[model samples]
Target chain A: MTPALAVRGATKRFGAVLALDGVDLAVFPGEVLALLGDNGAGKSTLIKCISGVHRLDSGSIEMGGVAVTMGSPAAARALGIETVYQDLALFDNLDPVANFYAGREIAGPRWLPRGLRLLRRRDMSRATGELLTRLQVGIADPHATVGLMSGGQRQAIAVARAAAFASKVVILDEPTAALGLRESRRVLDLILRLREEGHAVIVISHAMDHVIEIADRAAVLRRGRKVGEMRPTPDNRQAIVSLIVGGDS
Target chain B: MTTGQAERAAPLSPATGTGRTRLAALAQRHGAALVLVLVVLLGSLTFGSSFTGAGNLGAIALDASYLLLVATGMTFVILSGGIDLSVGSVLALSGVLAAYGSRWGTAGAVLLPLAVCGLIGLVNGLLIGRARLAPFVVTLATLLFARGLAFAVTQEGNQVYIIPADLALTRIGQANVLGVGVPVLIALAVFVAAGVVLNRTRFGLRVFAAGNGDGHAAELMGLPVARIRVRVYVLSSLLAGLAGVLIAAQTTSGLPTLGEGRELEAIAAVVIGGTLLTGGAGSLGGTLAGVLLLKVIQNLINQVGTLSSAYQQVVSGTFLVLVVLVQATLARRRRQ
Candidate 1:
């Protein structure tokens, strides 16, 4: 099958620094592609280009075999691309339902401008409740704001939000970085669920164990280029590490 | 790991502890309303017929009507994690414009000020929102510009443009229904509409999201953060202009210096009403209570007869400080 997202010869530069240089990557639907790199290895730049945070200097991105150009994050979202940044992009003051549907609110009448329309609070709350239940993302009080939530719960909420609208791709930037052991496991399970639901998942992570645990294919970037790609297993785990660190396998 | 994988969702129980916390949150949220009630009761007991009198109460509401308009606009700005220092100046400018425009009839009187003030707000929005400039600095410049423009129109505060006494606009301001000033009734209508817009609309959600202390996050959520910012500033200036029009009608003249320092007063009222100065959470109801509380205290100070009028400022200042302290404490508790 054609990959859900394909990047060809992606090159990005910030001033004089070459962040992503002629990198080619693809991940099919229902697969988790862990993008691994050390500091300044260009993993972030590559994903930023795909997620529409930054434009590629000289490259093209195709979604489901159609070349598409996204000018902003909003444009990317319109094409079913969602990014859950390291910060989770959560409004601490808003409860889970409000947080889940911040911009894409379910409102009515279809005649008024998008801003003036009344919110369909019941519909949104019911949908949020169902989504959270399906993901097993437990918040003790659904009415309470995320400000009082634990790190794991917040991470799950963020992932669940992406899962709700991301029909084509879900890109997670270090989702488990701030989570604890149990929390990290929950987030990993959530990512696996995304894969099971047929999303193209691109995860940027530093944790080798997490990459090995949930990643279907590991793509390593070193010094602005794709160094290697492999199906991460216990047998070749060290070999993947060697690719990332520029050591001989 | 296998056992933990099947984690059960906790039943949402309103435990006694949670109930107590909820009650506390309620108190904190309605703190302004509570204080206003207490003050009203104390005033009624202390001053008897004068404080409890409908005429005095109506006068107090009339005084609050102008500030209420200003603070209503300020609520949107603060809720969106922004500030508009130009509101007072914008108010003055709109008033002068309204009075001068009265020469052309009611349409000219109302629409002219609104159009000009709305354009000024649009400029402020474009500068602060589109240019990504700091709101504080950008609105500060507009504050000076608007104040200067108001004076320029009035010929350096020398000319006081008067609305015709028989004009429809002036009649609306001067006329009362059931012992209430028309300005007070107009302010009440504005508040009701504002409350609905803030609570139940998509724009309201976006405002809160934009104020989430991280505009980037809101932007990533597919929100037009810049547009939201720009619209709020426009709304604020438009409201300020509306207030100026009412004042111009009430007094039958526009004084370029009428609204000096009113921006600070509006800010104080908003903060006292429990809207976080840093943004993200607040209500127009709280702001209403805040405005009323301030005006009521001023009226009470007048009723003292022996006390100096300056004492009004002292009480307002102290109350402002106390309210802020309470809010800060509650916010810290929430964080913890």
Candidate 2:
């Protein structure tokens, strides 16, 4: 089967600094790929390139065996690639359903006879509820504003929005960095659930334990270059940390 | 039962506490409108003859129509996290242009100001939204420029061109529909339309998001942030210009200094109506109520016959300060 996403020889330069240097990565269907790195490890740069926030200096990206050029976030979304940034980029005043359907809205007829156009609030809310349920999110109501929710609930809403709309690949940037242990475990479980749903998940995280928990494969980056890929097995954390810190190849 | 058993049997009831919290929130949100209504009722009871009369109410509503129109547009601009200090000057300029063009007919009077004001708005939007300039500074410059143009067109404020009495232009200001003033009806229609646009459309959501943040996320969501910003300024200026046109029609002449300080009143009404100066949230309904509240206060002061009209200004200024202080406190609480 074709890989869900492939980035080969991706290079990005910002003025005099090299953010990413010839990085190669692949995410297959139904797999969680943990992108492990420290600060300045070029993890964010790679995600930006894949998510179409920035153009690659030199490289190619392929989705479902077709080469694609992502010039904007909208373009990436059109290709079934979604990114949940660290901020989660949600409107706090609006409810979960509004946040989920912020840009994407369902329109139906105004009246039965002529039916011009109107928002399908019921359908959208139902879909939002189903997505939250599938992720085991314990939301009181989909109509509740996100500001009233806990941090973990907000994170869950973000992930559910991505998983619901993302047809193939979902990139989560530090999904649990600010969360407590219990909330972090909930997010990890949600990641595994995404994998089970057949999505190619890319998790950019600094926590080794989190990277080890739900990731099927781990790619270590140091100084804008990918150094090694490790299987999700015993002794993977130490090996990945060493690779991240410029230890043995 | 034992003491421990009795303690265990009395579970905490959070539902009542939650209900109280919700009621407090609603009161906080609607406090301004409620206070305004109470003040109006109190003034009516105290003033007796003048305050509660239908004719006086009609006059107050008619007098408020222009400011209401201007404030409605101001609400949108503020909600988008921006300001338009040039609106008063635009009103004067549009008034001068309408009077000058009145010789041609009603269409000339209406279209000329709209086109010119819209162009000014477009410029303001391009400068602020596309060039990413500070809105206050940009609009301040436009304010000066528009005022200068108004004076230059009227030959340094010496000319007062009057529209012919028999022309259709006269009806815009003087005409009444079903015993209500045309300008009043127009203001009401504008408010209703704006309410729909701000609440029911995807464009409205984007406006809220843009005001709430730097709009980068809005752009990511495929919203045309720059275009929306431009459209708001254009809409604001157009509304101001329309107000100017109506005023000129009503008076049958344009006064170069007609709209001086009107921008402040418009801003006051918008803020008093509950729109945050920092942007992100507002309501057209609140703005209408705010305009009427200010007018009612002025009318009540007039009825006293002992207080100067300046007292009205003093009262409004005090109210503005208090409301802003309360809003700031509430916003801080929400953030916490």
Candidate 3:
């Protein structure tokens, strides 16, 4: 089966910083690919390249065996690749319905003039409610502005939005870093749920237990280079940690 | 900044809290209206018949009409987390253009000012949106540029273009529906339209997102963030132009200095109405009440005979500061 995303010899440089150096990674459909790396290990940079925020200086990215260049974030999204950044990029002031439909709003009837064209609020609200319920993400009111939401609730909503929209792949950047214990599990479950739904999920995390519990495979990076890949198991954690710490070097 | 994980979130109910959050939301939305209602009641009680009389109230509404237009536009700009210092100058330029264009009849009078003002707005939008210049700096430069152009056209404020009384432009200004003036009616219509556009449109959603969320995120979501920013500035400039034209027709002559310091007034109205200067959250309802509060205070003070009108500014400034304090507190709470 074709991989959902394939990165071969991905290299990126920012001045003296070798952010991603010849990193090779692949995430297959119906699987969770855990990217394990310490700080400054280029996990973020690699994901950035895949999500079209950073251009690779050398190497190519393939989606289902087709070489593609993601010139912008929109380009990647057009290819059904969505990145949920650390901030979650939610407009806190807008309600859940508004936030969910901010960029992808439904328009009014065709007869309306340009000045009169409006968003279909009822439709957006109903759809958002359904998406959240389907994902089992609980939130107060669809009409409640996100600013009023707790951090965990906000995280759940963000994840729910990604899962609902992403047809091919979803990249989550430190989604659980700021979450509490219970919130982390919620995100972990949501990630596993995504994989179960047959969408490729690439999760960047330092939480080893989470990777062990959910991810089908794990890739470790150190100093911008991919060091090792392993089936995440109870017995292989030490080996994964050693690779992340550059024990081989 | 919160670590809202499932393990921790399950006990805490995942949906945002409804009790206190609902209360805070209500306060943020209604605080301005409450203050406005209180001031009106106080004014009515203290000033008695004069304050409540049709003539005085009409004057207040008419006076607020043009300011309402400008403030409505400012609300959108501020809601998008940007400011246009050039609006006042654009108003002045449009007034002069309206007066000058009156020679060609009503269409010239209306379209000329709009065309010029729209172009000015388009330029501001391009600079701030496309060029990625600071909104403050770009609008500040345009403010000077617009003011200078107005001065040049009016010959250093010596030349005043008097509107022809028989023209349709002047007639529209002088016309009244029932007891209320046309300008007053137009302002009401504009505010209603603004409310609908802000709350019920995709454009409004984009504006809130651009202001409340990260610009990069908006772009990543495929929103034409730059285009949206540009469009708001254009909208603001067009509204300011309309206000200018209305003011000129009402005054029956162009006054180059007419709109001086008006930008601050509109901004104050928007802020007092409960819209954040940082952008993302605001409503037209708050803006309307804010304008009314200021105008009512002005009317009440003038009725006092002994009190100086400068107290109006002092009160408005105080209200603005209070609103800012509330906003800061709310922001801090949200952060925590």
Candidate 4:
């Protein structure tokens, strides 16, 4: 099967530092690809390049086998690529409905300029409610702003937001870094659900057990290059660790 | 599908202390309106016909008209997480420019001041939005610059240009419909239009998004954060300019020093309306109530007849402090 998203020789440079050096990666639909690495291993840089936060110095990205150029996050989103950063990037002052559809609001009169368009609040609220229910992310008050929600709830909302709009790829960066044990488990469960829904989910994580738990495949990076790629299992868990720490080839 | 497991997990309540928290939220949002109503009641009970009389009420609305316009613009600026210290100066400059331009008729009187003030806003926007300068510093500099220009236009405050009483500009400024002042009507119209834009439109949502403490998040979410900032600053200046124009017409002359300290009054009104000084949450309705509340208090002090006018500021200052303290406490409660 054709990969849902593919990167070719993704090279990125920040001044003299080569953040991503000739790295290639791909993930097919219905698969969880875990990006593993230590600090400064270029995991973030590679994902940033893919998410359109930063352009690759020399490389190409193909979505569903179609080579695409994304000059901005909006451009990337237009092509069904969504990234939930470690921060979650939620507007604390906004309610779930507004936060769910901040950039891509369901507003009207196509002829009117983007700013002048009136928000279809009822439609947006209905859709948000449906999405929350589908994801099993429950908040008692739909009118409550996201700021008041728990960390786990906020994580679920962010992931659900990506799942709602992302048709091809959903990249999550350290989604459970700030969550507790139970909350982390919930997020992992959410990721598995995304995989079941046939999305190409790329997760960046430091937790080795989490990778072994939900990841269908693991690609390890070390010092700006792909060190190894394999199916992570209990048998080869130590081997994956070795690859991440550059202990052995 | 994780269906059974998902169903087993209970829905989390929005807050731990639901009843008390919700009440606090409601009060924080609508407290200004409640206080305004109470003030009017107290005044009526104490002063009788003098306070409840339609003539007195009309005068209060008329007095509130200019501050309402300035505060309305301040609402947008504060909502977008920035402050424009130059608004007071811009108001004074616009008034002087309007009077000076009145020689060329009403069109010149109206357009010239707006053009200059809008340009001032544009400069402020570019500096704050694009250059990423500190808003406080940028606008503080502009406050001095605009104030200087205002005095220069009137030859160092020596010459006050007076609009002819018979001129259309002056007549329009002083005009009243059904015993309501023209400035009051215009202020109301501006507020209504602004309310729709801030509450109902996509731009309004983006403004809220832009004002988030973490603006970088808004940008990542694909909002035009810089552009929103620029538009809000320009919107603020234009409204202040419009207020200046109307005031010039009413008084029939532009005094370079007319709007001294008005920016503080506008800020006070906005904060008293329950807009967070840190930004990202506020309402025009609350600001309308805030302006009215301040004016009503002033009128009430006047009704007392014995209290010095200086007491008006003292009361307003004390009220502002009280409201802010309440807001801060409520915000902490919500976060918890």
Candidate 3, B1-336: lDDT as tens digits = 122121111111122345665455456666788888898899888888899999999999999999999998998888787999999999999999999999999888889989999999999999988898989999999899889988888999999988899998898998888999999999889887876677667787678778864476677666778899999999999999999999888887777887999999999988888777878777777788788888988898899999898988887888789888987886576556
lDDT (tens digit, per residue) of candidate 1 on A78-195: 9999888888889877888888888888888689887678778888989999999898888887877777788888888999999998998999999999989999988999999999
Arrange candidates by DockQ, highest first: which order?
A: 1, 4, 3, 2
User: Per-residue alpha-carbon lDDT of model 3 for A1-249, expressed as tens digits?
Assistant: 899999999999999988988988999999999999999999888998998888999999999999999998878888988888888877676667766676667777869876577767667778888888778888766555676777888888888878877899999988898989999889888888898899999999888888899889999999999988999999999999999987865
Model 4 lDDT at residue B196: 75
Write the candidate numbers in order of decreasing TM-score.
1, 4, 3, 2
Question: lDDT score, residue B221, model 2?
Answer: 54
Candidate with better lDDT, 3 vs 4: 4
Tell how far residue A144 is off in model 4, in angstroms: 0.5
State the DockQ of every prediction: 0.53, 0.31, 0.40, 0.47
Deviation (Å) of B118 in candidate 2: 1.2
Q: What is the Å distance of residue B319 in model 1 from its true position?
A: 1.4
Docking class for model 1 is medium
Off by over 4 Å in 1: B1-24
Worst 10 residues of 2 chain B by lDDT: B6-15
lDDT per residue, candidate 4, A152-241, as tens digits?
989988999899999989999999899999999989989999999999999999998999999999999999999899899999999999
Model no. 3, DockQ: 0.40
Q: Per-residue lDDT of B80-124 in model 1, one digit per residue for the tens?
A: 889999999999999999999999998999999999999988998
- Candidate 4 docking: what grade? acceptable
Clashing residue pairs in candidate 2 are: none
